[model samples]
Target: MEENQINELVHSFITYDYNNLSINTEELDDGKFFSIATIEKNLGKQIFTPNFEAEFKLIKAISHPEIKKI
Candidate 1:
């Protein structure tokens, strides 16, 4: 695939999947917060390589501060 095509593919996938995911937060006894992402069981299997996982983590971490405010 061309570079632009790959970029568009990744962007579309992230936007769609992120919208579909369910995020939950909890307050720990020590006054800290814990957050998690959950996917519906009926959503079907996801296929991605380790690099994609790393990229997703990076994106999530970068936006965590803003996300925590919501």
Candidate 2:
């Protein structure tokens, strides 16, 4: 993926996770901010497959500002 696209993807995931978390702070805890390490952990042992199309769709969905908190 392109650098900008990658950055956007990372930002989207982090933002999404942050909004979902009950507690988001600078300190690392069980609710640490979604980060590269977190992404890597979740992607453990999986091959890196850059699917631009799906990624674009995911970014649009995750970064939607109207996503209601529940």
Candidate 3:
């Protein structure tokens, strides 16, 4: 990833197998979007890593309080 790259975190709706999960991000400043580059079985493992986990937590933290939690 480059210094100008901004990775938006996705909040998976989270079913038993992540089958019903949705990966998305709000329309960015330039109308660009990004989500976690995750594989189904590896979803959990990916989110557990320091980098992705922290970014996800940060996303949740900065999100509007009323619209948080899915």
Best by lDDT: 3
Give lDDT tens digits, candidate 2, residues 1-70.
7666644232234353455566555543433344544444454344333553355346556664543221
Assess each prediction's global lDDT (C-alpha) against the native: 0.40, 0.44, 0.46
Q: Assess candidate 1 and give its TM-score to the true structure.
A: 0.30
Candidate 1, position 61, lDDT = 62
Q: Among all windows of ten consecutive residues in candidate 2, which has the lowest summed lDDT?
A: 7-16
Off by over 4 Å in 1: 1-36, 39-47, 64-70
Q: Rank order by TM-score, top first?
A: 1, 3, 2
Give the clash count for each candidate. Answer: 0, 0, 0
Q: For each candidate, what TM-score against the reference?
A: 0.30, 0.21, 0.29
Query: Model 3, range 1-70, lDDT digits (tens) per residue?
Result: 8999766654432223445544344633332223334322344665354555665566656775643443
Q: Pairs clashing in candidate 2?
A: none
User: Which structure among the candidates has the greatest TM-score?
Assistant: 1
* Model 3 lDDT, residue 68, Cα: 44
For candidate 1, list the clashing residue pairs, or say none.
Answer: none
